[model samples]
Target: MRSCIPNVLLVSLLSTSAVICSPAPSAPPSKGTTIPLTRRSVHKRSAAEWDEWAVRHREYVTKKYNGQVKSKRASGMNLLTDQDADSDYYGSVAIGTPAVSYNVILDTGSSDLWLASSSCSGCASSSGGGPTSAASNSIPLFDPASSSTFKNLTTPFAIQYASGQATGTLGQDTVQVAGFQVSDQTFGVCDTANGVLSSPLSGLMGLAWQSLASSKATPVWQTLAASGQWDSGVMGFFLTRFGNDSHAKELEPGGQFSMGYVNDSLYTGSIDYQNVPSDQVAYWTLPVTSLTVQGKSISLPTSGSNQYAAIDTGTTLIGGPSDLVQSLYSNIDGAQAGTGSWEGYWFYPCSTSVSSSISFGGPSWSISPDDFEHTQVDSSGTQCVGAFFEVNTGDNTPGWIVGDAFLKNVYTAFRYSPPSVGFASLSSTALGENGVDGIAPSATIGSPAAVVSSTGKASSNKNDATRSRGFSVQILALVWGAAGGLLLA
Candidate 1:
């Protein structure tokens, strides 16, 4: 059942992480244009410290990495094994390829799946300071030339993010997810684009550690549903960033990715599958029970407004109505700073003392302390750190993105679209339909709270090739005209 619970306090939730695949090709980077961020006042730092600053001033890193931000979701087609020239990130079903390996982006927003074209010249848009090359660079791009399953939907797709857009072509391809490969799934091929490329990540394979996403697909969770594999239910993820030892904290080369829980960690409750408006321009609108500042409840303008919220996995931050943010910032001491803090975006006062936790929603779902205070500092010897994002779609802009900044803390589930419009997961995950456990927050990762709702039932748009990027709604006119022509004949 696609459900959206406002004011109803469901049980609190918890969380779960990882990446897996074949050996990657040795593709390296070809340098390109880069934008230098030089702030005499705030020096850049390392990933460690950045993690700290993440909790204090979220606007910092997202703004800092503004130029580097991009979007991707898990994507693939038929599970046939072959000798294809693909990398671990972009795997192929070939004799030489061995088995199924994928390239996916860990997202915390909307649930959707898609891929990039092996022939994507779109990556050429990088400004000289382009992506780091690797052996996989030689792998055949998502070339329609190699696969007969590729079908031109004649559709343009673009996911606009706070930093940039992941634009591409929407087509039907045989996709593989969670070991189950589908004959036809809606996938995207980035033919033209701008922004992103800090690493070799091209397509996003989302099962974010949040709800709602920066783009149309939302997250891999949604894409799988559209694909027939796991189409009956929403998916889940576990984000583990910690290490067994301090020295072991290095990012695994090429890394491992997954769609559901990996560890025994438990969750607290069910998923809130709020139905997004089917008009393509839809969003999740849940009620705000309250916004507490420094342990005190602050008032917001969200009351009675069909608060439009986007669950974004591609984003690391959470942004929305000023009132919601203001309340959150005020509760924490060093969470907000001056206009100079986030370059005037929004920030925690530099002098504000950091608080342990900030509460929200009705009394039913209360956000915890540690989850609200996660951060990653920078390499510089200064206070600059790695903070993800929290943004406004603009004044009266109808949608707000609640990103990983929120999801990394809790367990979340998305009930597939059918009898209802939602999903479920427990704060402990022990209560969900799946017997899997939720996340056990270590010194490594973030905490929880969720996109509260219950179920979702959405119509699959397989023949939606006309709904691609740049096409606008004019295709609908063409469809109508064709229908008229057929009638006249």
Candidate 2:
């Protein structure tokens, strides 16, 4: 999402705070832990390039999941990354006995963890072909032959995305995150990959429940939960945003990923929890009560598919029905349909005010004006690309995917006990003085702020389903090198 599309053009930015309707529980993790996420180091690309990439990225995801693709809605939780270059995020995950180091994208949208294999075709070193992007060329490839602990599984693992597909053999290895390690974890080692799978990211780690895992094997978090890594199957994500002006820094901590522990210092006040609807449990899906633009509540059309929303950290932009997207953008001053290479993307006057917010059930989250003014469409910075896109999945189906465009605004939490999602304002300390914390001032979101668990006491009711691991919104926009050069701001 561009940094400057707030207001009608900015609804995607405010979307980051889509809170659930359920009340937050009282208890915080008594002994929470933090795993710092390092952003991928990026080669400088201009705002126009980023906007083009976002369009292709959105198209890739839409074609992969929506349309006639017909893939199961796998339940996966992503301790997703907030990419500084707006490409994607990666984290350190070790596999094998000697624990070979690899940086993988923390994707919540899809299941199955796959990596480039020593025998990969069309790979950078292979003859078939290799990565097309400059970013993908510098990535280190994985060689199963080097990992002593690797055991091949003939499960015929394969995954399809809008960009490309990863087809490889299944294998078991000891997967480690932070200090918690899950032995004999199943993963895919790609023998061949094309499309987006050829990126610089070494691999991907899926955090969703076991049900959504394509490997049909226990996911890393499930393995950790079974091993008593934490009290419950909870994953926390803290997504941070970097201003366009901060490009000079070699690296920035774009966000954080918490597996079994919560860091209380990352957020302010209490956390608001929302239940994941029974029907939409595969994803961290929730209901959107309303969408407010310029202080006016825009009515959502009820004629289409079942209304539901998925909190997808793997995505860079937001996706909605064509009618809703057109309606939302209609509120912007100079918004127009994309043309030529910018097709499927929305364009608007760069100087427009994106004063808007979205409501899940509780608080109305105002999109940041800076987030709306995402990137200048040209060197003049007079026009910007809008973050929201239209992905018409036809009628009589599910739609609406909220990605990083909206997620970077608040601290997000995912709980597996009852399968719910939660949102809270960024702690004042993290935001400093100028950062927009919590609900935006004067946006007039929803009713009074719901009660937050001040006691940090766990909920005693077994069926309450409100359990969470508290984490804040600070992350590294660059990779964590062996030398401690990791940046997490």
Candidate 3:
């Protein structure tokens, strides 16, 4: 029978995290001891299995730099922000049928843990669609009613993103992932949410610093390390889209999301760091060396607007005020303007003139020409498409933030211990090892151009059918194991 999750063979998983959901429960282990996850390093799982990993990591994404921005320091550099500080990053910790794992955003920012809940209310399923294939029907679910470990937490919940926002319940449950397991762990869940959300994602799990986590006893990452599940408290990630073409293609065989770092990765050699100002305790504000339009460097308002550039791993596009973006796009050859919508920013052109790039930090990396092209039918029955930025006439300082769109070229690193971040790039071979498969393997996007298009939006819609771990291991393990005990009772 056809199945959406083909290689997710560890066991039954229950959630289909299209836009939102979570659950809770607990069960005694079969052996009375936890089993560490087999995955800890990169490129270990096969292609299909890696895809399964990405599906589960959704709840664990976090913002690189988070905090309160004083208007005085609010320079032109767009910082990361969510209307609701608590729920900004999309990350999660989930207990699936086969196993419990950490599903977080492969963000450049910080990393931590948040789990999905058993009480999630999902979107209505299509009634007319073909019935679930036998394999598809086997996904598991986590039921908290029978488990004693599930506990509702007091942390208030909310998440705000430039793209959209998610609101839900917060609570603590048993969680095991990437070889770590902790009882009474805290996480957020949005059972029924209404906000502008990316179609590809269902729930988020934060992995940044402890500040982003709802769990009070221990930060998610530290908890994992304490459990002796991780090699170290350190977490490694290689985002697929930011690398060169050939390496990115190989990333598909490598699942878009997997734990641990790529082996022997390269860096710019220098580790440039700026501590987050106390006033902006949550976010690490970085200084802008300069601004450039195409290959030519341009003048900016300078002194006032250059204070902090919010490095966010959650966003797919780079966002900045219209005045700044206007000058930047003007320099890219073949770029034109188009209609604007929250669906996404629009640019003009038919045969996309790509390979152009916007440089930051200290490198002259090239932007792929093909990364910005799209084809749409004009009134003349001709197809038209181009770069991805739609000027938001409605708002200027509408949080002009840089997204993954711009950061992909740099070898981005997040150092949470000091609350600072670092950047560099990897070799071609390394890029091939870390991408595409982590996000979604079925997608065939090429560079920024393909991803920027509405087609990418449609592809993300399919995420709705993605499944949650079917049954709670802790719950089922105890229930089935106690059948003999029930008879004795």
Please provide TM-scores, in order, for all candidate models, with all chains considered together.
0.53, 0.74, 0.56
> What RMSD, rounded to one decimal, does every model reach?
17.0, 11.6, 15.6
Best by lDDT: 2
Candidate number of the best TM-score? 2
Ranking by lDDT: 2, 3, 1
Which residues of candidate 2, in runs, are more than 4 Å off? 1-36, 40-55, 67-70, 73-87, 125-138, 195-200, 301-306, 394-398, 433-489
lDDT of 3 by residue, 1-489 (tens): 000011111211123332112222232222222111111111223333322222222111122122213221121112132110011222223442223333333333333333223343321111112112222322222344534666666555544432233345556665543323345565554443222211122233444444433332344444443333222223433333322232322112211222222223334355344554444333334544455544576455544433345565544445454556566667765555443221233444544444455433455445444334322325442333333343232111123344444444555544444555555555565445433333222211111100011111111112222211111111000000100000000
How far residue 136's Cα lies from its native spot in candidate 1, in Å, is 6.1
lDDT at position 40, candidate 1: 7
TM-score of 3: 0.56
| Candidate lDDT values, in order | 0.31, 0.53, 0.32
Local accuracy of candidate 2 as per-residue lDDT tens digits, 288-406: 77887666777774433436777777766677877787788888878898766566668888778787777677798777766655455677767776777777652323577777767
| Candidate 3 deviant stretches above 4 angstroms | 1-116, 123-142, 146-148, 154-168, 194-202, 210-219, 222-234, 242-251, 254-262, 266-281, 301-307, 340-346, 350-366, 372-400, 433-489
